[model samples]
Target: MQISYLQQWLTTPTYKIHRSQLRFWFSLSLTFSVIYSVLALELAFRGNYLIDSDARQHVFWMQRFLDPALFPNDLITDYHQSVAPSGYAALYWLIAQLGIPPLILNKLLPTLLGVITTSYCFATCLQLLPVPAAGFIASLVLNQTLWMRYDLVSGTPRAFIYPLFLAFLYYLLRRSLLPCLIALALQGLFYPQCVFISSGILVLQLWRWHKGRLCLSGNKQDYLFCVAGLGTAFLVMLPYALQSSEFGAVITAAQAKISPEFLPGGRTPFFHDNFLEFWFYGKRSSLVPRLSRITPLIYTGLFLPFLLWKSSQFPLARQVTPKVQVLIQGIIASLGMFVIAHVLLFQLHHPSRYTMHSLLVLLALAAGITLTVSLQALFNWAKCSPKSYPWKGYLARGTTVFLAIVLIIYPVFTPFPYAKYKQGKEPLLYEFFSQQPKHIMIASLSEEANNIPSFAQRSVLTSEMYTIPYHVEYYNQIRQRTIDLIRAQYSADLTLARNVIETYGADFWLLDRTAFTPEYIRGSNWLMQFSEARAVVTELEQGIIPALSGIMEQCSVLETEYLVVLPTDCILKFAQRKRN
Candidate 1:
């Protein structure tokens, strides 16, 4: 095909779109989604091994289900295992039983999910606007947006939200009751917070705004869909509320507000002193977050309403389906939940959850349509050569081609991913720790502690990244553990160090070369969450000699340039020998 012919075919018309055109557009959208996903999956394979950072907390424990003895009697293991929803855990367990390692599965799942998510996104956009290329552009932009972040690559429970939620949207648009319910059930099963969001959207469907007045929908089918979808949400969510966890009751909103864990600089910090940010613009609390900035293609979505309103200038508005209003309903539902989440704090989980998913999807659809309309207008105008400037046609063609290239590669070429999709660095250290007995636990202040569980298949007393304080029983234990570990590390007294060892069954005390320095405690965001870390930093700055600092050289079991692993038993033995 000639380049001009191909360009004209791809550029969707503002009016008179055909059924065959829709099929071709859908096929092209799927092809692009596959290409983008393949490029991302290839990045995962660039290293000898790679692990998703979020998977460190969520997926590592699944290794135990595959082999019963992997993390026996381990606090971190048992807690992470308990917190995982039954379905998410069962899926990983089933995969693990089939001889795929959890880490391996994590690497592979993202591509499949990306393709699935893009497919549904395209179908959903097609329902909103039958111009097939509009759906094509929207799916392309959505896939690019997803890839620029760790959302897809993480392959954690949160990763399931895009595909499951998009599938629900697509099914709802098609009025496929059974599949819609199944999507709702699967979302509840994996990411339960989304079930509430889905329920809110479903509830909105029953209400309609008619000519300046609010009224219920005339369709009985709307009520029927609402009842079935909402009922499924309640049934799936009921188990979480009814079942008592060994970790005890869920932490109330009041409890979380006072806890330093929610303060600025702390892990999962939601309450910012800056009122604007706390209410509307926090990274985790914001309506859209940094996604718009990361992928500037989303800005095009703002122009969609303008183009749509002036239907004469942009006849693409004629192709729009009233069903497109469902996305607006999703946005309304998302914002409602975001505010409720903020008002209730951690009670509804993170406020960002409400907006990020819907807003991104909505923006992608609108942006796709906007760009499609722009390219179509430009190409159609190019056919009529201006009498004076023959280069006008050539310039239009170049601009369209450039825009397509920029959209396709927008965030992939960025130096950093929008989300922190970390990979473990120290393979030698991981291998060394993996050789230890299954029951042995390590104590550390190193940030590397977060990566240990997944990379080494061993447990740590606590890690900065894994400190999600949603349960009173769990948070209390973790808070105390953090205090004790910090205090024991800096104590000049041998008695306190031995107490930490006995209290938590610390088989090994892992220390970084700079672990006892005051700056280490003061600078770390996670350590500041503990009441003990502040005092420890002050005491160390006062030039108090540390007991572990002295014993680290004496009881060392393993040594690397920056890391020192002191056997707790060896330290106790040294103390006993001195007493003798």
Candidate 2:
């Protein structure tokens, strides 16, 4: 291809794309979506009915919709089901009514949602930039960002945030009021946090920048659009406001700061001593970055505005749409909500939730535009100096090709998109526990306890993985269980062990074969959260004979190298026989 042809495509690719151009853009976007969809399906079927970790916490209770007998009288199941959004639950209930299993639906939904999300992302970016290639590249970057996390693959309430939020943006840009309202309502129904973001945009649209000052729009349609959109948002959110969860009041920042469960190494581990993490990355106070790690490309979005300002160096920079202002409105609104969330503490939910989805969408678009502009700038420079120094042109074009490959190709090599948060490996263990009575409660501190509720259809007294300390009543109960389990496991007194089983009404006591060792307690995050457990650990280190350990071989109904399951009844019977 001639350098002039490449330059023309980079600089001005038709504002109203040619039929052929649209096909090329759609083809690239579709290819990326299909790759992600296939990977997600493969991951879904990779193990023994594997579910994402967050999905386990959110979607496991939905199985009851298909089989009413599942998770009967289970705290974790009941709590998650109770807290799940009315619309989210209803959507799955409707799917289950089609005779599809929840697991099957969960696996299948991501592929469709991924396509919908990508389509809207592409359209929204196109609406902003008008270049179909920009839209395609934006969606490509978005797919990469999403596949890195569990949001899309989990197919939980959070999964809808991307598609619904992007749909809202697309409709808003098109000034299509009815569809926008529906997207707004779905956002509230599905992911609630995103409704605030949509409302922010609506609110911003009512105010227009004119003559170098921000002035309220006098346009009647603007008022109507804002009114209709905000009204729909209010209607959807009102139900949640009126409803109450049996889990009790959400935990406050004051309460969380004082609790061990929110401290370092605690279950939620939100409050960090490190300043950067505590303020900017804290789950409750931070922005989109609440996690300990994320793809490095996410940071490129921070430099988007700077590049836009210096667009003069490259003519291709002119393609960035003025509608990029909408994303700025979203960030401003997200930040405002983030501040309010911190001020109100748990009343508004995690601060990170408010910003994460919006920021990711914005970042992906910005990164896409930035990469496009940077490559175009380099390519354009290469052609300009071809005659003066032919080597200069070759050098510039070679660098552009290398950089383009790295930007476009980097995401595929990072990690397997399908290897999500949780997967089931021990089929024998799952099958054995799943056969137990629905009302049976298993008690354990081992990490395996985390999998039982999802795989085995039983309640765990507590598990280290899912002890999100957002509710005082729930976390307190879990906290007490952690303390008692640790105390009972390390005590030489047989009565102490029996009391634990009686107090929790535990049907089975799942234990690691080497749970009595000093390392187990020291390594256990849940146990170490309580200062009381430290004394227990110290006693065990000095070789205290654990009453539970002595009875394991006699009472265990099943034993593996890694774990043993002791029936509480058998344990009590063994103690009685010994006493006799």
Candidate 3:
């Protein structure tokens, strides 16, 4: 008797109740999005010295927007700024005009983006299934998945993709031509790779499955819509294709294959020995990366087709709109781009980029519909059970309630603050550099150099974060700089150190306390790639104290527990003293 009432409440709402259900679900979806985003913001602002891991690479350069004096003629800053998408840069510049520095804005922007993504996702789910409850579940799943990933919280160009892409999907499904074109244009300006996926979807829409075979879409409106979308896509993508980078050409697969930067422990780590990892789960190469972790309940989406086949038993399945084909087209478009990206290699960026965002959106819709259908099925079974089989009704009701409880409480057990915020451990180290002249460049072989640019707002000669090797010209300079720094840091002669300091205009030398030891050299994979570093290890093992170490007490300007900073003038003076 209770089962019938529950089914009626879910499936047979009056028009006024249905409107209220829509309002309730939409509000819930937005509420969850706000909650997740607030948690990320908490970590982002938890410490004055914290930054999102990727923001250290992409956003550090944006500090120049507020003050042009920062990172002047800086190679690391220049390369990153040049590669930033125009629209993304402009947005930051505009925000900076309003006096919010990019780093602070970067921390706050994700909440707004998350809210927009939640709004569009909920509306799009409604177009697919027309069930307000399903929309809530879909947006809920998408929010949970996004919060777990670094992409959404990073506030980089890719963060714009979710809202822009979902808006494109929603507007297209609604047949709103102008809005869809605008979404496509914005996506191109923010993340151009998604324009290809949008184009692929437009092309695929030109066909229709009729009877047993596929044929061209009979409606003229379909052709008109697709042609307009494709034309807009072409216009937005043309600038990226024609424009050449000052950093020279993107590294080819042949080039990356030979470089240590692409090896197992290398910076990028693209080529893996494990087949499953390389083809299926590799961060760069995979078709669908992090499948299980995408959403805890994503596996339920796999049962959607089966449930749809038994639609008679799952009454809610019949309410799924024909527009659900948009989900299928999205999957095909993502997969098609994924395959093309692999064949073309890094030219399209990473293959995983083509699929991961779209996968989350598609799976969320499928899983939401599946959850609603399954619940209704259980309720139906309970309602139809014979009086003799009272236990069956109890089992059905228990299962239905249990599924709902798990879905609601799943987030509490999962880890929090997956925002991947990297905190600066050496406050003294950053304070030291922050006080230096803006033009001053610090030279270092220590991993701590990676955090210096963002935390100290000062330039470093080269650090692990700045060693991105996608552009041949930029990386070649970075590689040589690394080699030179390694040799100078460990050489017994002060002459090599003097030459490197002069060549890079390095104002200071930063060193780890253990920098002179052989174990330090042996443990650093980045340094070991160069023969100079390996030779230094051999020298240290033979009890050859480096010239820099011999003068450490006199040359040191500032000393911390783990680090020491030496002025270049001091090093140069020591070289002169040794010559006399």
Q: What is the descending lDDT order?
A: 3, 1, 2
Count clashing residue pairs in model 2. 0
The Cα error of candidate 3 at residue 491, in Å, is: 0.7
| Per-residue alpha-carbon lDDT of candidate 1 for residues 1-580, written as tens digits (9 for 90 to 100) | 3335744576555255567877777787778777766766667667763767778788888888667888778866788888898778888888888999887888788878888988898888878876667778898888778877777778888888999999999999899999999999999888888888889989999888899888899898888889999999989999988877888677777776787777787787767788777656677777766544447887798787787777666655766778978767888888898889878776677789888777788889888878877766665566555657656677777887788789766765684334455767677778888999888888888998988888788889987866778887887787788888888788787777788888888888888898888888878988887778888888888999887788778788788888888888887886566557
Residue 83, model 1: lDDT of: 84
> How accurate locally is residue 380 in candidate 2, as Cα lDDT from 0 to 100?
71
| Pairs of colliding residues, candidate 3 | none
Rank candidates, TM-score, best first: 3, 2, 1
Supply candidate 2's per-residue lDDT for 221.
85
Cα lDDT of model 2 by residue, 365-436, tens digit: 777676666667777777777486788667766775675575467766667574465766567778898888
Residue 201, model 3, lDDT: 84
Q: Give the poorly placed runs of model 3, Cα more than 4 Å off.
A: 11-16
* Cα deviation of 304, candidate 1, in Å: 2.6
RMSD of each: 2.8, 2.6, 1.6
TM-scores for all predictions: 0.92, 0.92, 0.97
Tell me the spans in candidate 1 whose CA falls farther than 4 Å from its real position.
Answer: 1-8, 11-24, 377-399, 416-419, 577-580
Full-model lDDT for every candidate: 0.79, 0.79, 0.86
- lDDT value, residue 152 of candidate 3: 88
